[model samples]
Target: MLQQNLYNWRLVILATAFSGASALIYELITSRILLLFFGSALTSLTIVLIIFLGGLSLGAALMTIFKKRISSTGLVFSILQLTIAFYGILILSQFINLPKLFDALAKLISSPLLLQFTGGAIFILIPTVLLGAIFPLAIAMIIDGPNDQISSRIGWLYTLDVLGSVTGAALAGFFIMPNYGHTATIVLAGSLNILAALIVFPAGKKLRLAWLIFILLFTIVAGLAIRNQKMYVIPKNLATIKDPYRQSKNIDIIGQKDILWEKASPWGVITVTEEETELGLDKILNIDNWGQCSVLSHQSESLIADGALGGKPEADVLNIGLGCGFTLASVLNNNPHQVTVAEINPVIYEAAQFFKEYTNNAIDDPKVNIIIKDGAEFLRTSQEKYDVIVIDIEHPMIAHSSPLYTIEYFRYAKEHLKTDGRVALWGYMSSDPRYLKSLVNTFKAVFDNVVFAEFEEPNYVYLFLASDGELDVKTIDTKGNAEKLLESLASIEDVAPNTLDNQILQKYFK
Candidate 1:
């Protein structure tokens, strides 16, 4: 009794769920993987997405041509294709030197824009073709006759997969991954794929049992191994403590010196550290780019030293893209003052306590209140005012973070500011001049005062300080919580700014 055609309905349901999970995982890796190398530039994001989508669209078209010739059950082929595509995507993102590939492709393709688009396009063809083939192939496999009504099945499965993608995006963006790190996230996604394969094509009792055990062992081992993958050892002068949450191998303690106290979850890394010479456990470690290099003095220093500009009332503090707890750490460090942190991901609130820096007393501070919504949307909703806000996110490099930087967002930031309140804006140059000018013009529309300032020698941060009224750094009072913070900054007196001795942002962030 082979019962080849008598598979249970439960099998199909499991297939569908597995499909949803795989789809989610694939999308996450697709959208975010190249960030470390590409730095999430608009060019990088557009290339990846356009290529993937275009390939998918192309694949869907081709499936019609191939479906008639394929054998029974497109499910097997679809799952296999996805598994292959997943591995390919990971290799391109992590193992390969994609940055070099991108450069070569740029020269080969001629047009920079076209080159980027093509780069993503080339990567997209595999998954897209397979994905495109899934629908028609599945329908052909499931139904008994050419005229059979399988619309309900198709509709339900399609809807479920899309819903799952949204869920994945929300979960990864807001919660699960921010505290877990990317490798663990990937492994979780992969296990779902393996599960889908077993359920859809479970050969026999003995084989099925073996697969289950294998998967269990594989997941446990993979999770542990990749959990600490992004970490490495960095030389420092503080007392390094093992943080299970961060899973970073590079985190070091330079005696009483500041160290990388990073918390990496799906939410990205929330890192805080100080230098040795500027000890009292206070001097902030100078980090060039939070999204890229977060090295201590060896590479360079932080552009804007923490609390460098000084804190003041009517200061409109803006947190553009809130990550784990580090940005919140900066906000709470100067707390008891009214603070507004704009976080697009809801999961950040849940994992706030996972990182000791933000958990113990940081989020609990009376002055802190967070809006768990899009930073751009929150900007539109604000009628109240602020003193200082931190822009903790970057643009669409791997995925798409474009909405945060559009003219519309800048205009809203302008309106929410007190006439004297200034806005802190970060802009990177993996950019077109038009985009930069658009940003410049957008802020100019709202305020009469704007300064395009960048740090020299150590860090390369281009900070935009804008005001509608006067530029007065002298009138602000550093009393109460700010005073204590100031005292901490002052204690690292030996750590001077703009030297081999210290970094500006590094000396102040504590």
Candidate 2:
């Protein structure tokens, strides 16, 4: 009997390790899925972490309360593991419908924060609670024998659990997510939970057949569901979730158009979309449904290059962010001596091939040199100076974009500019006034004189031109364009500059 008890203890420890691994794997995948519904705000990420950890804490508390009544520890542990597997599979299968659910909840609750909290509680908390109960119950079972050192055994089991979690995090991030994608990763984690349940099921002939049949059926169903499910399909009803600020209008456009090409990278999801606009077939590039640029906006691109170059002909220009090559094409039209483009994502360069016709074959031009590297890092390390530096990146509100807009990055760009050279930064006027003020202040912190230019009709782009010396409106060349641009710049309200230590734009804008 003593030997049998020792054998059971070993099995329980192994099962707990697997359970712990599955719990962490589920957390990683679920967080990615939730980001689709709730925009990637710091507050949203914080709320998600809190919800997951809070569920675990609640589960442990409940287990402690009922420790005395849990007569069959193995049976209780097996049931909890099975339940976690069941709920994980069920939630993943229904994930595509989350946007519609959020929309319905939005109608009932006006506050976006409250709606996100409610959605998290319904989708993530329940299964995580079950997962939390598994550890304590496993401990109870292992400590049943008098010879068992409760504290030491608990420590040993916990060490195994943590080791399993570390392995799970690495696997989920590096191997499973990159190769099999999100749905498949969840399925893999769910399978681990089912395996744990089989290992910890009560050792008897009474319910062994029943448990085996249940696990088999679940595995088959889950396998088929994962195999059949389409990867990254935006729900049809997602647009019904209203955004008064129009911050998610780009997401709606992505859902409405036909996706020509899509790639999932560690940075974010890169999608090339073709949509019929008033200008005709427009090829648009997006990073995680945030519109980067389009090939249809030649006029806006021309205006941006003209304002930045300050009418300098045959000048060397540095263009950061190769978004569909619209800006590069515009620069080439002016017949620049050299145009060096720094694009961080190679996928964007590959996608640019499809838009070669729209960009006037700028990618193949001998004068245009495209380098795949981070914009800020390239600026810091480059030895050459530029006649004009154009910073046309994604909106600062997006994740990882704040770094490019910080004071440190702007100062680096300033260091690379020639004495008489100018820098042009592109931003949208559609953002909040406070956010816009913060951006303007950040630019002013680097350059002494800064002016703004508004692009032609149908495009809401605001071009910020900055220089060490006073900006000459005559450089704009277009009649009355300079005065009009400076007028827009003069109207901006003052605000604190964005720095590496204090990212006011990300904190206030989000």
Candidate 3:
């Protein structure tokens, strides 16, 4: 009897470790899915973690209350594992409709935070709760051993569970999701849940052979069904969910559009979508559903190079955010002696080839050096100075992108600039004038001369030219946008600058 009990306890320990790994894997994968809807903001991650941990806490409380009712800890543990697998798969199958669901919820709830919380609960609450119950039950069963070294046993179990979680987070983020995609990663997690259940099934004569065989057959069929379901593709139109002004426009994003190219990466979901415009076919590059650049935006992007170079054709330039290679092409048009392009996402660099015509094949140019690193990080670490530094990144409201717009980032750019160097930043015109004014003030806080350029057609997009030296807007008017830029700089004052310590841009958007 002693030997059999020891064997069962060993299996329970193994099952506990597997359960820990599977739970973390589910959390990461679900958070990534939510990222496509909510964007790459910390808010998106916060909503997911809150929902997952909340459910786990509730599940643990329930398990403690009902411990006496469970006849066998091992049997109940096995059942919970199976339940999590089923629930996880069920949730994944429904992910394709998330955009429609989010839109409907947005109509009723104006708050993006509340909508994200509601969506996260819909997708992950059940599975996380089931995951939470497993740990407490494992402790109860392991403590049933001889009381002499019960503390040691519990410590070992806790250590294994934590190690398993670390492994799961590493694999899901760096290996599995990037290589096999989200569907396969979730399926793999579900398979581990099944293995955990099979391991802890009542051992020997207590094991029901019929039940074991039935579960094995059922899981195989269910796995196949999950594999065959349609994969979710985030619609191009749904990319504006984060912007309250855009979402208020009531853009219908119900149906799926044909995707030209798509890949899941550690950064986010990189998608290339083609749309027919009056001029021709325009391909758009989007990261995490936020449109980065399109062929049509090349004219606007050219202004970055125009303002930076200020007619110094041979000036060395640093261009950030590859985005369809439009700004790089514009930099090349200036005939810069050397151009270093810093782009955070490797996948975006790969997608640059799609816009070869519009970009003048900028990625393959002999004068260009492409470094796959964050623009802000590159500036801080590199000692190389440039005559012109162009910041062509995404909106400041994005959590990850917010860092690039802070006073600290401008200071770094200032450090790496030559005596007569100039910086050109692509600015987002927020619906709220306060945030827009804050951004301009932030740039002015770092440089002596700051010029603002607004486009005639796209009223929301603009450019900021900053330098310690005298920068004439007339000197860099390769395009006509800068013709009126000097007149607009007067109205921006009395606003606090957006800084790394206080994220004004992200808060305003939220």
Candidate 4:
């Protein structure tokens, strides 16, 4: 019986899934879209969620408006066309006059709280409303007239739709956009819309030609994106959703040469480039979440770098967050350490190696090793202790990470450090006082001696130098060593400091 219904609504099922995938891709895009300009984890996340659910909600409400009004499959497809058209406009608007719209939104909201609450809500309203409507309308259209067992058929259709949604998301996230680019993905969604309409009301030659025209339009958009150009908004100062949190925003290319690399998620862009360069420095090429490029580089350079670790690590060091292998690369330039780095996202590693400027020659260092895993979890289970542990993940907008910065996580970090080990953490800070203070407080709860430094590069990097023993970076500041380190540290972003001050933390306290 159930299988029969699935057979009946198969076309609609496919269409819904296609639509669902398109919706999700847009949601991912929404989260990271304005990044290059207005990017802060919290702020960007707030906007992304608001726009996403808002559109979903809007879709739901519109479904209520059409409740029981459309009886035939033909009518439903017609409405689907209208809904897609509406979503198309809203989606395109972000890329179209994006800079102006972004600035205007920024201007009207004087309060961060207000801006976050309203801005997020507004951006999502349109699509949420539309996405919400599809399922019910689809069922109504598919029912076999009044004689059709509407309720049972609807339930069965829903099951198929849900399955389709799941499949669509997996395919789009893992494959489609990464290889195809945003414009192509949208066109893909639009094609689904046109397909659904045809199934419900098979179009004649003229209508088919019109659909062909749209495919062409989508092709043109894809070509433009290929040139590394995008129709995106230029934002004002990127604000954090909550005051005093670390953040960054920038557009990343997904594919270069002939690989599948596109914006993956809220984290950032992912690309796969070849590991081609090594200046006689051994290095391991890696990408976003996992990398050990520096271990390789350092083995060759024989230089020592310091951060989260209390002291320079032993010959072999373990690293976290393979961000272009920068921190590790910096380490290699300073010391000759056999480094083992753990990264969570393989896609990131792939991109760093292929699309971005990562080099395999780094791993050529006899001392470097790469592991893919989560930092906190890896630290918990591993029997190894490092002289220097660098925790450089600063993703605040994604809610799951809050615990990593909590005092509880710090306790775990302490346990992993050797008696005299060091921990280095870097975070992005801007003009917001509220966010900066909260960051300090979050760190203070776990460590005993937490000291901070302000870098002068205009991008203020709060360097939290912490350990159980008494250590003052000020002591290391003799001639220009402190200043130079501070200068370099200032340039490095992506952090969450565990040495928060009560006063600083209280500034943003509710």
Candidate 5:
């Protein structure tokens, strides 16, 4: 009897760990899934976290109220585990339909927040509630007597669960998601839950046939999950455009080239698409399905490089982002003495190979040095001072891009600039005016002399030049730049400068 009890305890512990690990894996995957549908806004992330934790709390409360009615705690625990595993696979099958559901909800509900909350409840909350009940149910099965010891036993089980969660988070982020991709990771996590259910199966001898049937069903489901795993991946956030599913049908008609390279990183979904332009086929780089930069427009690139380099010949230059190598190639046209490009995503650097025609092989140039690191981190650590520093990262509204627009990063750029050097900051002409005002105010706070220029050819682009020394606005005006664009910067009404503490661009723009 003692040996049986010991074996049961061991099984319970193992089951708890597996449950915890699987739950955390679900959380990580669910967070990414939510981001794909809702976007990478802070509010979206906060909503996901809140709904996840709230579901756990609700499950715990339900378990507490109905613990006595459970009849067989071990059987209940095993069933919950199997249910989670089944739902994990089920959710993957329905993954692609989320956008349609979101759109429907948006049409029905006037409040965006309410619509988001409803979506979260359906996608994230229900599954998390199942996950949250495992701990309480496992505890109920283990403790035979002595109500006073219940608290300590719960604490010990909680500790084990947390350890498992930590392991799951590390493995999912560092290995599973990065190496195996999202679908395979979801299968792996669901498999863990199935394994946990099997470990606890012996505790419910009265339901032996039921357990066997469950095992067989779960095995079949796992096989189906593996076979249909391609459908399990989180779809790219193509919200700015049409639905990704529908967009594929229009790709051929539009004559856009098939994706040259694509990678789903911890940062965001990175894709390279080729499109025929006036200057022949040009490659465009997109992060999270938002078109960031491309090598198609020589005019836009020239404007950015000219505004940044300030027509300095044979001067040292630093390009914060190396997207498609357009800005870098344009900077090279001026014959800069040396050029250093910092690109955070290594995938972007790899994708650049396909754009050799567009970039003129500038990445391979002897004078150009490329660093695969975050732009802000590089600026903070680098000791070299450059005559010109160009920050051509994506718009500030993006969660990852917001860090570069902070006042602290602006100061870091200033610290790395030569006494007479200029720092050119890129903004989108189509950006929210409030965000633009905040960005300009942030730059104005960092530098005494700031100039703004707008480029309307090919694409609408905005540029802000910041320097301690006087800027030749007359020269910029002579190049057909809009004077009103510069005047808008000075006429900003009431907005605070964006700082690291309060990233106004992300807060308000989103």
Candidate 6:
């Protein structure tokens, strides 16, 4: 009997650790899913964290209130684990509808912050609450011994729980989500919860029968989720608060055939979709549902060729992003001595192969040297200076791209440039006046000379160029529109520049 009690105690400790790991894994994956529905803004992240922690607190309070009346904590803890597992699986199955739900909510709720908070609460509150109740119940289960040993037992349980949390975060971020994708990772987390429940089940004929039923139910539902896994592909619409889903032309299309290739990465979800346009086949690259570049889009080519070039014929160039490899191809066309491509997501480089015909297989070029690192990090660490540096990242409002638009980023770019070197950035459609003004001010604050040119062929996008020395405006202004564009930007005054400390750029996006 004593040996049996010792074995059960070990099992209870393991159960506590498993529960902690599963909870954290669920939280991280939940945050990633919310990032899809809510724009990847600071507000969206804060809303998720608040909802999770708040729900946990509420559940713990409720558990404490009811603890004295409960007779069988082992049974209660098992039920909580099973409940979390079942609910998590259901959410993973229904997560694809989040975009449509978000769109519906957008029509009713005018405030963006409130919408994010409400959506997060509605989606994740139950499981997080249930998760919160389990730890205290586990503590109650094992603290049935001497009063003196109870403290050490609680300390060990807490330590194991914390260690499990760290393990879960590391595995989810670095291994599971990246390799297995979101749906599979969530399923794995749910399965861990089920395992934890089994580990803590008290020995009895009736309880054993109940455990068998739970296993059967879990297997059936998990099998279904795995079978229909592809249905949970993240939506490509509603990239930001400024853009709505109904406004997209391809809103009518459904199913997963349109998604040519998709993968989840540490940075974000990298997706390649094919569109049968009137012109031809158009391949688009998207990061976290924000369209990065397209084969048919002239913006990437024009941004590099028209803006970044014209500095030196045999210039050594630095390209920040490799979307569709169009910008890299443009630089290569000019016969640069060497082109250093700094791309964060390696999956993006793989996706660019789909547009090899248009990109001239830029990723395979001998002159191109690929460095898979964050653009700003590369600039801060590298001693190599380039005659021209092009920033082809996504919009400044995006959480991942926000850092590259700050005053500090511009300074890094400046420090990595030669005396006469120039830097170019694609400011996609300066529709928001304050955003444009603040961005222009940020650029002007760092460089001696700043000039911008606007294009209207595919869509309205601005190519901004900055140099320490005088820029050849006559060469860049091929259509005689640079002067008017510069005048319009200069008219807006008293605008504060975006900096690392203030981060004013993300606000203009909202």
Best by lDDT: 6
The top-ranked prediction according to TM-score is: 6
**Model 1 Cα displacement at 420 (Å)?**
4.5
lDDT of 1 by residue, 43-110 (tens): 45556666666666776677667666544453454355445435543543352355667777876777
Q: Which residue pairs show backbone clashes in model 3? A: none
- Position 218, candidate 5: lDDT: 70
lDDT of 1 at 439: 51
The whole-model lDDT of each prediction reads 0.50, 0.75, 0.75, 0.51, 0.74, 0.77
Model 4 residue 338 CA deviation in Å = 3.0
Tens digits of lDDT, candidate 4, 1-510: 111122245566556665665566556655545443343445566567766766666776677675755445454554565456435543553453555655677788788656655655555555556666776566654565355566665666767666656765666666765555455555555555655555555346876676567556645554554454332222232221221111113334333222222334324344322222433322333222223233223221111134343244343456666655566665664464567777666554543442123433453355767787777677768888666666555443333344455566677777777776666665444455455445555656577776555543223344555577766665322223545544554555434543312222222322
Against the true structure, candidate 6 has what lDDT?
0.77
By TM-score, how accurate is candidate 5? Answer: 0.86
| Candidate achieving higher lDDT, 1 or 5 | 5
List runs of model 4 lying over 4 Å from the truth.
Answer: 1-14, 32-54, 63-76, 82-97, 113-124, 145-148, 177-181, 202-266, 270-316, 322-326, 329-337, 344-363, 395-404, 430-441, 475-510
Give the per-residue lDDT of model 6 (tens digit) for 144-245: 678878888888888998898888888887898887678777887888888998997877999999999988988888888877644323334312323211
Candidate 2 local accuracy as lDDT?
0.75
**On a 0 to 1 TM-score scale, where does candidate 1 land against the true structure?**
0.61
Weakest 10 consecutive residues of candidate 2 by summed lDDT: 243-252
The local lDDT score (0 to 100) that residue 399 gets in candidate 3 is 57
Over the full model, what C-alpha lDDT does candidate 5 score relative to the true structure?
Answer: 0.74
Name the weakest run of 10 consecutive residues (lDDT summed) in model 1: 498-507
How many clashes in candidate 4? Answer: 78
